[model samples]
Each structure stands twice: as structure tokens, then as C-alpha cells.
Target: MNKSIETMWKQGFISEGELVVPKVNDLYNRKSQNLVDKLQHMFAVNIKAIVIGALLLLVVMSLIGAPWLGIYICILLAPLVLMARQELDKSYNLSKGQSSLEYLESFNAWLHDSITRYAIYYKFFYPLFYVGMVSQGLASDAGTRVMARLLKTYPTDYVFLDIPGYVWALITVLLLVVIKYSAALYRLDLNMIYGRQFKKLEELIKDMRALKPE
Candidate 1:
């Protein structure tokens, strides 16, 4: 390992979940700055495309004053939402009793759930945890476009808007789906290994506690 990555690993800088501090020398950090710098490029290529596409459809509807598309947009994203939910459920199921995070003794002792010790945290984080530093601006324009498509009531004119917003919106949604899907699978694999380890620890402790006084 390079000295920087070595130091980061030694310091336990790589971690998961809501605690999403970026580690030094990580791919998102100094070690691969060039790669991380393309995060916006990825978003522009992926998310922005689809969001814009969806908005364009709405715009097309507006130019003709069509009413069908209002309800269509409502249902248009249903499949994506369903797929996202399926991805999340799969991760939660696969991550049962795995360790994705841990705090010191006192920090955890206060938690009431036995599974919260280390294992269940895997499930908690398996859905939305950032693996490395986030690809900042990866989906920045998605939210704005989604809201605009949903709430805006402006007149639609195709001539001024040469660019394809509907395509951008569709690409954005697909990118989010793919990213979440991959992370879910990665989390599932990690939790499966750690889940077994936790089970073994439980068995070992039970055996030791049952031993007769010597």
C-alpha cells in the first residue's frame, strides 16, 4: 500500500453509514484526485440527462395543453421507485446480523437493542451509506428538476430550449438506481461475512460462560 493509504487504514479512517467522513488518500481524496474530480461529469452524463428528459415530456404536454401527462408523470417514475425499494429490501434482508459499524463500550451499552451492538447496524447502513467519499454533485440537479417538473406551470416553448431535459432526467434516475443497486449488493456481501463472524462470537461466549468453575 502507498504510505497515505497505509496510514488511513491504520487510523481506521475508512468507515460507513451516517458517519461519512472522507478518509485521506482514499480514491475520493488526494490519492486519486483526478478520478474524483469527474464526479460531476458522471452526474451530468447520468442523472441530469434523465431529469431533463422527464421535464421535456412535461413541456411537450404543456405546449399542446395536454392533460394526460400530468397523471403520466405521477406514474412514470413508479417503476424506478419500485425498483429502488426492491433494491433496499434485498440489502436489508441480506445484511441481517452483520457488523457495518461499531462504537466504544459505553457508546453502545446505552443502545437497548441487542442486535444494535454491531450486526444490525449493517442493515441500517446498507441502504444509504457512502462507500468512499461521495461523488459530490452526482445528483445535484435531479432534485431541482424533479420539483420543477412536478410543480411548475410555465408556458412550454420548444424553440428556446434546444437541449433535451427529458433525456437528462431519465439518465439521472437510472444512474441513481444503478448506484444504489451496486451499493446494496456490496453491503450484502460484507454483511454476510460479518454476520457469520458475529454468530460464531455468540457461540464462543455461550460456551465459555457455561464452563464449570475450575
Candidate 2:
């Protein structure tokens, strides 16, 4: 044990004669690998989900006669899905023969960057998602007929300003609801994608940082 500690000290992973913060051992390495593997699994799941979601969205839009909108959404989401797969692949190709601390540090940096980029991408992408779905639904055959009837029936009832009263009122209300909840939706989406694994990685990183040699 003393010899291993001395060797680790010489390797710059610990301070001379100081206690290791996370107690460097096989257990530590295993835990790190487990956490990282879990994250990779999540990325894999997300890739599949994205593909499935794209297909479903395309089918829905095509049924509604808005195949173009569905195609557009797939195009927008493709990059995000690709990005995630790329990151996961990169993580799996981690450096061989690295010390546990070095491995964790490298993983930490990659995980941090990956999480930030994914969050940013989703924040921008989701609003577009919301808009595409809503607008496409409204442009569908049934939707158009409903709007036509509403306008025909209540031609003079202005909901607000120059907009028709009942129709515009409904539109205005839906729009406001979407706008009000956009931030919350983004948070929810991100949490669903990266929350648990992200927090685990964060806690591991924190523990590793605490153990860093002074």
C-alpha cells in the first residue's frame, strides 16, 4: 500500500504524504466507469428515441397532409441526434492506460462540455419543435375546416383587436399558454434527456475535485 501510494505521488495524482480524498482504489475506478457507462447508455437510448420520434412525427404530418413540416422537423433534429452519437462514441474511445484520476478528469471535461452543448441545442430546437407541431396541426385538413366553420359562423365577433373574437381568443389563449410554458418545457425536456446521469457525473466530479492534491 505504501509503495502504491508513493508511486501515485510520483505520478502527480496525489500530494506527498497526504490522504487521498476519494481513496484511490479499484472501487473508485469501477464507480467512475459505471457512471460513464450509464451516460453512454442514455445517449444510445436518445439516438433511438430521436429516430423513432422523427418517424412518428413524419407519419403524423403526412397523414395531416403536411409532410413538408415533418421532413423539416426531421432535418432539424438530425444534427442533434448525430451530435449525441458522436459524443458517445468519443467517450467509448477513452484513453487507454490512464490513471483513475486522469481518466476521471478527462471524462469530467467531456461530460461538462457535452451536457452544456446538448442543453443549448435543445433549448433552441424545442421551441421550433413546438411551433412546427402546432402550425402543422392547424394547417391540416380537419383543422382548416374547423377554422373555416368558426369564421363563417362568427364573422363579426372580434376576439381581440382586429382578430375575430372567438377564434382569435382561442388562438391568443393557446399562443399565450405556449409562450408562458416554453421555458418550463425546455427544462422538462432537458431533465428527461440528461438529468439523472448528469447529476451523477457532477457528484463524481465533485468528489474527485475534493480529492485533488494540493
Top TM-score model = 2
lDDT for each residue of candidate 1 in 22-108, tens digit (9 for 90 to 100): 432132223222221232233234334445565776677567554354335534444444443443333223321221122111112
Please identify model 2 stretches exceeding 4 Å from their true place.
1-24, 63-66, 93-98, 152-184, 211-214
Judge candidate 1 at residue 195 and give its lDDT: 52
* Per-residue lDDT of model 2, residues 33-130, tens digit only: 66766766677887898899999999997896788998989998899888988888777666644565666678778876876777677666766776
**TM-score computed on alpha carbons, candidate 2:** 0.68
lDDT values, one for every candidate: 0.37, 0.69
Candidate 2 clashing pairs? Answer: 157-165, 158-165, 159-164, 159-165
Error of 1 at 202 (Å): 39
Q: RMSD in Å for candidate 1, one decimal?
A: 19.2
Clashes of each: 22, 4
